[model samples]
Target: MKKYIIAGLLAWLPLAITVWVLRWVINLLESVFDVLVQGAAAILPLSTHDVLHQLVEIPGVGVAILLSLLLLTGIFVTNFVGQWSLRQWDALVSRIPIVKSIYTSVKQVSDTLFSSSGQAFREAVLVPYPHAGSLTIAFVTGRPSGTVAEHLDGEYVSLYVPTTPNPTSGFFLMMRRADVIPLAMSVDEALKYIISMGVVAPTAEGLASAPQTTRPAGL
Candidate 1:
């Protein structure tokens, strides 16, 4: 009986949450169309309002517009001038006081993970975390540097331990390269596995040829 209940829940939970969130977003966007219709009805001449009336009556067009806007925004930010402006904005934020500490740290981590040159999450690794004898999933976030590297005794690399169901947030740690086990999974596959809470593990082999040797201190 317990096994059946667990199995049924596993099948239904993801579908239920996905449908609910998508419907909520659609409804929110649809409200914008409703406002446009009400405004047109009050002010526009009947002849001009006819097209607005007809168009706003459609169910999902507002959602389509919202998605299109987001797509265009993404494209715009990827260009040279937009990228430069974004960097300048970040530089301004880094000059603030309390905000600077939080924002700069977050920006560094995000850039290291999401930037084109970021190697963080490029490889899946295994490391003991939280406690000894307990292995946890980690991603190689590159080597430590400056004072941090000097303070540590051995070759150290940064690793991120992503939490289950939310891979965007996690704990960062510096560990000896020799202690990490490189996993046989691509970054995308590892992400899916983490977000799905291990339910969607992929069988594709990417790290099959990786040697079992530990990583050096720097990287």
Candidate 2:
């Protein structure tokens, strides 16, 4: 009886989560769309507000409107005027002190993670972290910068060591470039291995072969 219950739950769990995520996204888009419509209508008249409120409330209309707006925004942002406007808006935000710090930090992360030219998380590496003789999987974020780089002298690789079951939070480490061992597996494959706590291997061959390491050498 217990086995049957567990099996049923296992079957339904993924589907349930997918549906919940989609519904949540749709609801959020709908809320944004509703606010935009109300704001636009406010300038016209009270009659315009009544009509738009009803229109925006139609079952899936807000979702459709929101998607259309995103498409238009994508198209517009590719043009010169839109680019100039974006720069202006960014400059305005940059002058806001506290908001600038938060916004810039988050924007930099988003750009790094999504930009085609981004070097972040482009490779999986093996490093002896926490202590010597311990091998851990980390994603290459890029090279070290500023004072940290100057102090390290030789080439160094910046890496993100993600935690198991929840990969969103992780530690950042800077290690000697020579000390890092590159992996054959892709970033996605490496992430799966990490998130599963090594129970899930990154492909049969990639995980099976032992990677070479480096030492502190004569200093």
List ranges where model 1 is wrong by over 4 Å. Answer: 1-14, 24-66, 87-106, 165-169, 192-201, 204-209, 215-219
Instruction: Return the lDDT, model 2, position 93.
Output: 100
Cα lDDT computed for each candidate against the true fold: 0.80, 0.84
- Segments in model 2 whose C-alpha atoms lie over 4 Å from true places: 41-44, 205-219
lDDT by residue (tens digit), candidate 1, 1-219 = 999999999899989999999999789988876786788689888887777777787778877876787798778889998889888998898888999999988888778767987786788877777876576678887899988888899778898899989887999899887878777888888788788887887786744525745642333
Model 1: which residue pairs collide? 155-217, 156-217
Q: Which window of ten consecutive residues has the lowest lDDT sum in model 1? A: 209-218
Best by TM-score: 2
Residue 203, candidate 1: C-alpha displacement in angstroms: 1.8
lDDT of 2 by residue, 111-188 (tens): 898888999999887777777758788999999888777888789988999888799998998888887777777888
Q: What is the alpha-carbon lDDT for the whole of candidate 2?
A: 0.84
